[model samples]
Target: MDTIGHHYIVEAAGCDPNVIGDANKIREIFLEAAKRGNMEVKASYFFKFSPMGVSGVVIVAESHISVHTWPEKGYAALDVYTCGENADPEKAVDYILEQFKAQYAHVSEIKRGIEEEDRTFTHTILTWEERLDRRNGKP
Candidate 1:
């Protein structure tokens, strides 16, 4: 099977710190992104820090979408990963970025698991006698 993952970094210059500190707002943004990306969310959880910040994850049938916020720094990070072809992680990332409304952001994406160039191939030439020897090794 083919697998793909999108990891992103959000750098904010002029964002409301209070918004990032709210767990409910962060969760809402993530759930909306998941819907726009066509991900089937199986479970979800969020945690509010002692004094600031919010962290949460939405477990989806395709894989998962997660987010973490830093109100003090006006920054947030996200990871959207999936194992199948039906989900569009990039769309999710874009939507989340827009929600953040950061003055500036540096975003990136990568393909995870089963990359073609990273694969290895083996070729063997064998006769009937060699094939018999191979079977012996299997046992």
Candidate 2:
């Protein structure tokens, strides 16, 4: 089956609190990630919560990359979706994990718009966990 796009869902734990709490920083990181993924930037928006955390999105020609952070919990959730062969969604995901300094991450990749023989559209998913850094007593 052929997929029209790739969607990466990420659960990043033990991230840097300062990085995730700053809306400006997160916006910068997301834009850079999109560029590295071979995506063309369309528009972007970010918001800072009352006391903590940040939420942002970078809309790209291929698709979009978005994130929400929980500074108190040292956690972040991200979605990287891209269409067409030219873009690599994984690159964006990797950049995010690196910039956040995540100690552990659980990632899921969904192949979107998969066409079946009967002309019905469906999706396939693959998931894995990555121990990005070992210093923080992560399991």
Candidate 3:
């Protein structure tokens, strides 16, 4: 199987103190950022009062973006996961950071793919080998 995708985790600290605690405000921030990043959002939800703070998720056609806000600590956690060659999650991350006016941010990106695995006959060969071994009474 061909697996190609990109996933990003972005965390921000010392966000604009004003924007950190409210779920509604956080939702608005994400909506605006999505527009700025040119991402197509299908649906979104936000919730407040988690131990970690407020949390929200935006389900996008490209993938999804999620945020957790901690106004008490002036921190927010973000994650963006996307598949397909054209999904630019980095733009989304940058837009979010800019919107929140994050003072210190940490971003981690991971590229996913399958490299050099013989897919054609490996399964068939393995099955045949297993059958032969069974016939030979080798558990």
TM-score of 2: 0.92
State which candidate has the highest TM-score: 2
Worst 10 residues of 2 by lDDT: 130-139
Could you tell me the lDDT of residue 43 within candidate 2? 97
Pairs of residues clashing in candidate 1 = none
Q: Give the Å shift of residue 28 in candidate 3.
A: 1.9
Question: Model 1, which residues run further than 4 Å from truth?
Answer: 4-14, 115-139
- Tell me the tens digit of each residue's lDDT in model 1 across 1-139: 4454444433333345666678898789889999998888999999999888888999998588877788888767767776577777778866766666655555444445535665843322221111121212211
Candidates' RMSD to native: 18.3, 2.9, 17.1
TM-score of structure candidate 1: 0.73
Of candidates 3 and 2, the better by TM-score: 2
lDDT of 2 by residue, 1-139 (tens): 2359999999999999989999998998998898899999999999999899898999998588999999999999999999998998888898888888899989999999988899999989999999989643432
Judging by TM-score, tell me the better candidate of 1 and 2.
2
lDDT for 128 (candidate 2): 97
1-139 per-residue lDDT for model 3 (tens digits): 2355566766677676567677777788778767765678899998888554787999877578898887777778888777676567767777676666676666666655534456432111111101122222211
Candidate 3: stretches off by over 4 Å:
50-52, 113-139
Residue pairs clashing, model 3: none
For each candidate in turn, the TM-score is 0.73, 0.92, 0.72
The collision pairs in model 2 are none
- In order, candidate lDDTs are 0.66, 0.89, 0.68
Model 2 regions more than 4 Å off: 1-3, 134-139
